[model samples]
Target: MSIFPVYQDVVSIANLSKEQLPFFMRHVTVYKRKRLHHHDFAELALIVEGNGTELINGKPHELRPGTITFLLPHHIHELHTTESGPPLQVYNCLFDISLAVGPQSDPELSNLFMNSVEEFPAYTDLSGEAFEKMKRIYLELFHEYSGSSPGRNALIRAKLTEAIVLYIRSRPSFPVPGEKSLQPHPKDHFWEMIQYVHNHYMDDLDSTLLSEQFGVSASWIHRSFKKYLGQGFLQYIHTLRLRRASGLLIATDMGIHDVAVEVGFESYRTFSRIFKEMTGITPSEYRASYAKTMK
Candidate 1:
């Protein structure tokens, strides 16, 4: 199923009730695609049919029927049809956290479903019978928001809260470490390798080099990295690069070209392409705007 009537840049403050939160529902019968540029909200997408790749931080993850992925604002991601057979159908919902609370709000709950940090996008999935329950609740909330029933707004808020809270409370495993390995084994060399990559990301990095350094096969590195981080190796490198780029843009007056090379990109063109693909903006534009905000 394709998510047609493509909704882009949908924004809402965090405190919105079911009635207040922006509601989007549609059917895409053809190959429909969208890139959410520099959004200030978190999003939840449910795929009802067909399949595609969810490109997050430069990695392509398979999106299948029954797949649900939540995107925090910091994540530079997009959805596209991988093939030309049929259009995929999807539902996208979004809301921003900044509007949810004042300075005195509970930091945890108030954060909504986004990660303030550039860590692997935080997410959870409901499987088996759990998805069915959430779907029913979502349908009910959607219907209410679509109707004019009395107290419908309150009812929608209650139900939406229930759906989100249930997922939050169930505590799906963090993507970076996978759901397993809550406790670190002394010999868990994978964590050591991950830490190594995190530390040296800005330096010349590659799968072959990582394999040689870590004494593992390159393919093993690829599999383990994705299993834990929800992305492939090169994608993770680009994520680190884009994250550092954001910091430089926000914190320094360096030229965009210099910043690109400093972050390990080879050329301005490649840098701009990657930056736009990841954050939905060119490096110079991001730096200029961020500079304005800082002043």
Candidate 2:
């Protein structure tokens, strides 16, 4: 069995109700370093006190009071407390990606969840008025999440949205490489298409299928993907599938064929060819290399 951990939403978050939005918050103190792990839900953590190091996707960043780290689904990360410093304390909030990029969400807000190949940094340092504002929102979010008041869910959503907007505002904006600055498109449903693919990548997806589903021509879908995402539809789907397959190879004991099938490939040969082509290693080799790292 693989040693790495992959946290699932159903297992990690508690008190989730079908009738209510999926959100959880807690005040946590880290005395020792956590194991390197990834989860299938989005996380926003505010450093409340102490000092630590956050290693995310193989990059290390210092964590101190007023620092906020945003982790998307499947981002491998861990937290380490300094030996001489006090424990790292933070307000950790977890929620479904849908909460951040739902159908009703604004385009700018929805872009925040598209971290597969991000144009912005994953974590940002907030200070002065920004820190104070975020702290207040987090406090209110905790209260609403723990309380049974009417419209609590709506309030929680509003606060979360506010927090996200504030975080975005705090960051320095940059144009996407090879593309002009993004603008809001009232009729553009690209984000909705992206979200749909993210949720259903394990299913058979193609331009024709997506075109039919979205009531647009296949060529339009292809052009939108190329213009916005810098990749074709098939490429995007393969990237998502490969990412999931890689995680499974490291975090589960599923067979190679099963892993491929789990991520939507029908033929083992095709899966192996594509896996090696993209990752430059066979599935078994990838798993074995990760095992070596653990040892």
Candidate 3:
């Protein structure tokens, strides 16, 4: 997942009567894809119908119907569909790690379910019979979450427990890695540069320096930026600097010229010109407007 999960806050996937209900289910359909992100909760996603590549930590894995994947709290992933590819329909069941906190008095069932989750695959492509079973279990869980019957929340946990057992029985070889390794891996040099630019955006960073630091050809670096991030390095860095400068303006009383220098602009005039071009207001005016809104 090139995009980290810091952008989106905790996702409200589960609906529970009490605040402590440990399970939640939501349907996710991807038509116009958004940025890749990671979050603080583990999620189980079943692809009911779709064809695409699920990019997990910069590596691409093929996804089709009956595909089930378990994502750790820190897994960075995004679905990349072809230009004319079919839209994806997936059941995303997100729950906290605390869901596995206490055993439900049936230690055997708890062990089975928790073991299944701990050993779950990053991507599992189910075969004919197994695929049908997975799909059915996912549907059952979705229905349980959608209905308002008494004890629906408790029923969701039970259905999910059954689903995990069914999934394991489909392939008893628990804890074994699937075709794709579950180990977290580093991104390639291009993304390394992208990340470096993000971390050091306030510095006087550019393509030549980044290429030298990452030891890749400058043209390849430029191409990689455009290919992966859909923008040149300069434009991306400018956007980052603008965002930081705006934050500082709102959060601090720094002068406009100091803010420009602080954000690595050569002069306030250049900063103001570009800021206006991008945001359509002078820095001071933007801060003033923000202050008024706060008041």
Candidate 4:
């Protein structure tokens, strides 16, 4: 028996040879969007202006401005716009990872890839200043791509490099608290509170304030931190403080008491005790050892 032929438009830029160009970008406008589809290439979609539901691996998320996603090969997904809602518009940038195979083989560049590619979340919300920075990059990329300027390839690579570097260095919205058995549903809220604490770790951080701000149960907040962060909330704060103190010890000539206060320790006595407990050495001893090593 003979089988009938089937057809699908592979996710590739038309008129482009894979051997020549590995990067492509386009502005997309859709009144009615396509169904879930898989692609062999990776994609980065920046929501320009649209309201819709994005289904990724069967989970749905409300997509709006400042929403960005990095799609991996074979990740099944699609978008659906509301009838009375806004139009579905986006800038979709596609690239072949094979283009960077040689660079990625080096340890330093591989580390860059790890942070920019492997460590990124599936989707991120970029708002306020972060969103503006992304918009600028997108605009520059578009302008350079559309113009037939000299050293075009080099400039395009520079734009992409800037974007990737920004992505890697941007502060993460969530916590990657090591590998452990997740406590269950509702426990994932650890990251939301974690971000807030990271921004205010130098201030007073307590379960009560976190619960009040996040609207979750105080016990749940504490439990989430304990399970996901592998430590209780207070312990996490102390860890951050000690980390800052260590940096100050090495990078500054600040006195021990000043370093303690700089890192938010209430008093030098409490700071010294915690520092010794965490590092197994007094703050002054750590500073002395570091100074000697630098010589």
Q: Residues 66-170, candidate 3, lDDT per residue (tens digit)? A: 777776554567776556888888888776554543544356765755666556546667779888877787888888777888888787777776765566566
Candidate numbers sorted by lDDT from highest down: 2, 3, 4, 1
What TM-score does model 4 achieve against the real structure?
A: 0.51
Candidate 1: C-alpha lDDT: 0.60
Looking at model 4, residue 122 earns an lDDT score of 62
Clashing pairs in 2: none
Candidate 4 per-residue C-alpha lDDT over 24-86 given as tens digits, one digit per residue, 9 for 90 to 100? 778888666656554434667788788887765445666788888766544556778877887
Candidate 1 lDDT, 2-99, residue by residue in tens? 21111233322222222343333333443866552334345566666777766544445667665666655445456677667456777555544333
Tell me how far the alpha carbon of residue 152 in candidate 3 is from the true structure, in angstroms, after superposition.
0.9
Window of ten residues with lowest summed lDDT in model 4: 1-10
Model 2 CA deviation exceeding 4 Å by range: 1-3, 6-12, 112-117, 174-295
User: C-alpha displacement of 176 in model 1, angstroms?
Assistant: 3.4
Writing each residue's lDDT as its tens digit, candidate 2 over 146-263 gives 8999999899999999988887777666633332212234454555566567657788888888888878899888877777666777877787788778766765678999988988
Off by over 4 Å in 1: 1-7, 11-32, 36-38, 98-108, 111-120, 169-171, 177-295
TM-score of each predicted structure versus truth: 0.47, 0.59, 0.54, 0.51
Error of 4 at 146 (Å): 2.2
Better lDDT candidate (1, 2) = 2
**Candidate closer to the true structure by lDDT (higher is better), 3 or 4:** 3
RMSD of each: 11.4, 13.0, 10.6, 17.8
Candidate 3 residue pairs that clash = 1-57, 1-58, 5-38, 14-24
